[model samples]
Target: AQSVTQPDIHITVSEGASLELRCNYSYGATPYLFWYVQSPGQGLQLLLKYFSGDTLVQGIKGFEAEFKRSQSSFNLRKPSVHWSDAAEYFCAVGARDILTGGGNKLTFGTGTQLKVEL
Candidate 1:
């Protein structure tokens, strides 16, 4: 079974400062990783993903993540953050469950809340 862990439950950053959110996974083989962001009343939006090929992946909203197999990490980073960026961020890993007829599913972290200061 695969799982994800987000070390920090909450993080605060200055409006224009840089930011990085940690995401670590426990999986046997090559894992499919993703980063998503959700606002107060909005659904999860895909930030970035790593399936294969390039280790460094770029995503929407000026976000990017690098997949590090050696470290078992896929950390999200942004050069600068806006006030609107303050939201709940999630790290997820896609896995297949044979118990469920070999269907694909995602294991998500508890999430990390971002609070931006002006």
Candidate 2:
């Protein structure tokens, strides 16, 4: 079964500090990975994604992530986090359906709460 796990339930960082959110996944083969951010009472916004290509991928808002096959991990990072960046971050893993020939579903982790201190 494919699954995603986010170990951190909450994190606090001073504004302008670097942040890293850990994500782990389990899948039979190479899986599509994604990172999303959600503000309070708002829909999720895609941060980044990895299907196949460079291991390190850049995302919006100065965010980036690295996919590690050996470790089954895709961790999200931000060089400098702003107060507005404080929100819920979710990591997801996707698998393509053999019949559909496209990724139709994704398994998301619980999520990590990010708090920024002034």
Candidate 3:
């Protein structure tokens, strides 16, 4: 079974500061990793994803993530945080399978609430 764990339940950072959201996942093999963000009263939006190749992947909104195979971790990072970036971030993992139509099923983490201060 594949599962994701977000160690930090909540994180507070001042505007213009750097941010890093930790994520760890357990899977039988190299699984598809993703980082999503959900603002208050909004739907979940994908921030970044790691399928294959390129350990460091660039994503939207000046965000990036590195896939660490040894650590089973895919941590999201932002060099400069903004007030509008405050949201709940979720880490998800899914297996890719031809039988299951590319393994659409995704198991998400508990999520980390990000709060930005001015």
Q: Supply candidate 2's per-residue lDDT for 26.
A: 98
Structure candidate 1, residue pairs in collision: none
Candidate 2 shows a clash count of: 0
Candidate 2: which pairs clash? none
Q: Which stretches of candidate 3 lie over 4 Å from their true place?
A: none
Ranked by TM-score, top first: 2, 3, 1
How many residue pairs clash in all the candidates, one count each?
0, 0, 0
Cα lDDT of model 1 by residue, 1-118, tens digit: 8999999999999999999999999988888899999999999999988888999999999999999999999999999999999999999999665688443889999999999999
Model with the higher TM-score, candidate 1 or 3: 3
Q: Write the residue-wise lDDT of candidate 3 on 34-110 in tens digits.
A: 99999989999999999999999999999999999999999999999999999999999988877766667899999
Cα-lDDT of candidate 3 = 0.95
CA RMSD per model (angstroms): 2.3, 0.8, 1.0
Question: Per-model C-alpha lDDT, please?
Answer: 0.94, 0.96, 0.95
Give TM-scores for every candidate, taking all chains together and pairing residue i with residue i: 0.92, 0.96, 0.96
Cα deviation of 31, candidate 2, in Å: 0.6
Off by over 4 Å in 1: 96-103
Give the TM-score (vs. native) of candidate 2: 0.96
